[model samples]
Target: MAEIKILGAGPVKRGVTQIAAQFEQGTGHRVNVEFTGAPTVRERVLAGEAVDVAVVPQSAMEEFVAQGRVSADTRVTLGRSRMGLALRKGAAAPDLTTVAAFKQAVAAADAVVVNVASSGNYVVKLLEKQGFSADKAVKQPDTVKVMDHVASSAQNLLGAGQLPEIRELVDKGVAIALAGPLPDELQSITAYDAAVTTASANAAAAAEFAAYLELPAARAAMAATGID
Candidate 1:
């Protein structure tokens, strides 16, 4: 059996885990998966980690393509995801019907939990595009920290002036107040792509795993994990 390795971000981790399990069962391939933030993934690739395949946002994937780190011909976009917001379940949802309202909500928020290494950059960019003051936006280091602050109702509470992780907040009873779901023109979406590595000892199997990602069933599983 060919052994394979995968590098990915959290949002894609759940979906990739499901897909990888299925692929291994069908092909008898042994697969190893490494999960990290988007920026961390970039750093790992640059560090020349021995991975057979990788899945990441299209823009980051493109960076690899540009650097000749990934096979140009094998690049494929599997799915897309938009930015979103979450609030504590019992908390009243804020007004996001208009761009102005969204801006105001963010500005007036006590805290915002964001995935610093992965989604944070995009969120910051969106805020800047909307003319929101960077100095005023409350920042959290990572998703876990964001959740910890919100879950504990600590000084990092979004309502108290912070932006927490959308998914983590939702899991912790936070509701969607304002976010990057469709119809919100101020949102940014990132395409997820997968490709085989040039250094893989099992190139054929790696390609097979990459191809499996495009299967209807696989795509459905991915969507269930919020792959859009």
Candidate 2:
């Protein structure tokens, strides 16, 4: 059996982890997935890490294609994850029906916890464009930390991140989703893509795994976690 090592962005973790377990069970291939910030995945791959598969944001895939870091023909669209907001579990959920309402809620918070990952970065950019001070956010390196910041604080802090990440914390009773996704027009949806890396030790197995991600069953797994 081939051993497949995959490097993926943190926002896609839950869905990918679910799918990977299923794939391994069905095919008898050992699938090991490492989830980190999108930026870190890009850095490791560009630095010549030999992971069999790389699942990253579509924007990064474009760069990888240009650099020949991954096999062009094996790339497939994974799914898109929407940016969202969360707050402490016991706090009243905010009305996020409009961009203005969303902004006001964030502004009135004691502090905002956001990661430096894709969704977090998008939130910071949106805040900047809306004339909100980005400094008001407590920037962490990943979604786990963003949730941790909120869980440990008694202050009214908002956590802005990928919908799936926020959902995980909400399910754990540490936080509640302020919105499934931000207001449509103001939302940032990150499309993720996957492929067999050029540095893969088992290219054929990696290609098989990448293609498996496009299956209806796989999409369902992703959709269950707010990616679609």
Count of backbone collisions in candidate 2: 0
The stretch of ten residues in a row with the least summed lDDT in candidate 2 is 172-181
Model 2 residue runs over 4 Å out of place are: 173-180
| Deviation in Å, model 1, residue 188 alpha carbon | 0.6
Q: For model 1, how does the per-residue alpha-carbon lDDT over 35-85 read when each residue is reduced to its tens digit? A: 777788888876666788878888888888887778877777777766666
TM-score of each: 0.83, 0.95
Clashes found in each candidate (C-alpha, N, C closer than 3 A):
17, 0
lDDT of 1 at 50: 72
Tell me the whole-model lDDT of each prediction, alpha carbons only: 0.68, 0.85
Question: Alpha-carbon error at 35 in model 1, in Å?
Answer: 1.3
lDDT of 2 at 185: 85
* Top model number, TM-score: 2
